[model samples]
Target: MTSTVLTFAVSALTFVLVSLTPGDAARAVLGRDATPEQYRQLRAQLGLDEPLAVQYWHWLVRAVHGDLGTALSTGQPVLRTLEQRLGPSLSLITGALVVSALLGVGLGVLSAVRGGAVGRALDLLSMLGLALPSFWLGLVLVAAFAVALPIFPASGYVPLTDSPWEWLRSLALPVLTLGIGGSATIAKQTRDAMLDEMGRDYIVLLRARGLPERSIVLRHALKNAAVPVVTVLGLLFVGLLSGSVLAETVYVVPGLGSTAVTATQAHDIPLIQGVALCFTVIVITVNLLVELLYGRLDPRSRG
Candidate 1:
């Protein structure tokens, strides 16, 4: 119910904001020197001369009917353009999540279980990750891996259908940039949750009753601590997905993020609106999934 209201609100607000932004769409397309007559005709042809309420109503109806209209800049169907770019964005985000999960959970468990030099080192690394900007990290990685080592390509995206290896290679730096930052967040949350779980009376009782330390930490503590970790993971995934704007721009990836940037720059109202709607939908969907996962993780919350 809330999601439905949010969707409509976002659509209306996005259209209003984009319409209000300083710039003439006609001039954007036809150039600054276009005469007033040309601008007037272009506005009429594009239906921009219509009343705001009427234009919004028409757009809402068309959107409901799965017709998102066309991009003012490229004249391509907004939905089709988004569809074509979806694959790369999903691939990049999924890779980042996987990388973050592995490194984060592993280091978190180690730091919680073993408190010594190794733990301190991991803590320091995570702090660095949290402090560094993804774009800066991306540039550094490009310099070292792409330029100095000449191992991975600095920028450019390859479709997975063409070759999985090539696609993964092209995505390596961007994924690392996003993943490293995400890992810090996940790792800290995991560590804190584990520490809290470990201090519970049940854990001490298990240890006193002759449970193996390994079993206590992995089978008992980790399972019970997972609820919070799951929460952080869900939020991190959404953040990374949204944060792809920087990654896509830096890597020259033709994903939704870069497309949104391009649309805004060109004053492509329909394209921008479509992108905004898609983002809101994705966020709502992820939140719903997270709620379901939370219920499963903590049976006490099922009621």
Candidate 2:
């Protein structure tokens, strides 16, 4: 309970600091040529010129009533905008999580069990994935598969309602971009954890008892190995949140990353605040899920 409260307080503080960023959307969109009266008027209109505490209170009240207000730049309802775009981002995250968990854990187990050339190759592949930046990789993919070969569209988004297949195609490049690094990281964590677990006396005893090698290594061993893997998954939530910026822009996907960067450039306070809070909530929620996962995986953690 104490930890959860602390997390909420920390998140609130982070949101406050983010909201206090200098200059409003008007100032950013319009140059310094805008007069002082204009600035004051805009501030009053935004209610941003007020004390930080006051603005926070107003936001809290409005949020409780389920009104997030319109974005200053576009005049779009902030909540509606988030709802419109969340599907793409959510889909990408889901795919990355599922694929990374499977490939990483499977490859990691294979590498750990076989200390030969195949294992060496997997290690090198993992390093390559980690070293490669996601955005850069996205561009390379676009060039090869989209532009040069014309296999996919160069850049654009199609609404799922309009064409689900097209929307899926649009997401392919970004998924590979985020997934490459995420999956590689997962594989490495899994391999290291599994190897460490395998060396334990209990695992050795299971192997000695003439248990099926595959069953003992996978069913029994992977459960124990998940402790570190779950930790990585919690940390991966941050990567999924921030790393989407590049991929979103590269693919022109309507994810939070694109909107957040646009808000920053436009100096839209509410939009930026929305982005920050969204990511903060995601991270905290993922961490809580991981805590629950810990209890599920290791009964001792329930204590």
Candidate 3:
């Protein structure tokens, strides 16, 4: 319920901010030499001459019906454009999430279980992962894998319909770029959670009962430690799904993030609003899923 309200609030906020932002979308489209009269006519045609509240209300109504208005640049339906981009974005995000979850949880578990040089090294790597900027990491990956070794293709998106293998190959660098950053965050969270769980009295009790360390850690500690990690994973999943603009831009993928960037730069209000709303919906859905997971993780949270 709160997430739904937040979605609406964010959508309204996005609309207001975009509307208040300086620059005339009409003029941007018409370019310089467009006189005041030309701007007036264009604004009226685009319904921009209406009061801001009226404009927002109109947008809200259409938005509720899944009609996000038409893009001024392409004259295509905004929803249609988003629909076209959704698949590639989902594929990239899914791949990244899987990689992050596996690497992060595995490394974190190992780090917790082994408290020596190996653990220290994994901890250092996690720190580096957090410190590294995503865009720079993306560039480095491109240089090493795409340019130096000529492994994965440097840029461009391929549809699954064309070739499943090619589609997967195209996303390698972008996935790594997002996954590496996400894994760092997840790893840190997982490590902390595991450490906390390990120090609990119950863990000591279980150890005293002669249960093997592996069994105790895997069956007991991991389940309890997973709650917070699951929360972070939900957030990371949303971030990836909404499209990592930096990663997508670098990879030249026609994902939601890239489309939003182009629309915002072009001052395509309808397109921008549509994209922002879609992101809000995705976030709300993910958050709700996280809450559900919380109930499962800690039965006390159910009430």
Identify the candidate with maximal lDDT: 1
Write the candidate numbers in order of decreasing TM-score. Answer: 1, 3, 2
lDDT rank order:
1, 3, 2
Candidate 3 per-residue lDDT, tens place, 214-282, comes to 999999999999999998899889877654787788899998889988888878889988888778877
After TM-score superposition, the amount by which residue 112's alpha carbon in candidate 3 deviates from its true location, in angstroms, is 0.6
Report the C-alpha lDDT of model 1 over 1-303, residue by residue, as the tens digit: 899899999999999998898886677999988899999999898888999788889899999999999888898999999899888888888899989988888888888888699889888888888999888899899999999998899899999899999998999999999999999988888888888889999999999999999999999999998899888888998898778988999999999899989988888888998999888888898889889988988888889
**For candidate 2, lDDT tens digit of each residue in 1-303?**
755575446546855766666656667655799998888788788887888788767776676577767788888988888887677777777667766777777788888988699999998888888898777788898899997898787677777788999977877777777887888899899999989988999988998898998898888888899999989977886778777787788778888889988887777766766666666667777887999999999999999
The clash tally of candidate 3 reads 0
TM-score of each: 0.96, 0.88, 0.93
User: Which candidate, 2 or 3, would have the higher TM-score against the true structure?
Assistant: 3
Q: Which stretches of candidate 1 lie over 4 Å from their true place?
A: none
Q: Rate the local accuracy (lDDT) of all candidates.
A: 0.89, 0.79, 0.88
At residue 262, candidate 3 shows an lDDT of 88
Measured by TM-score, how close is model 1 to the native structure?
A: 0.96
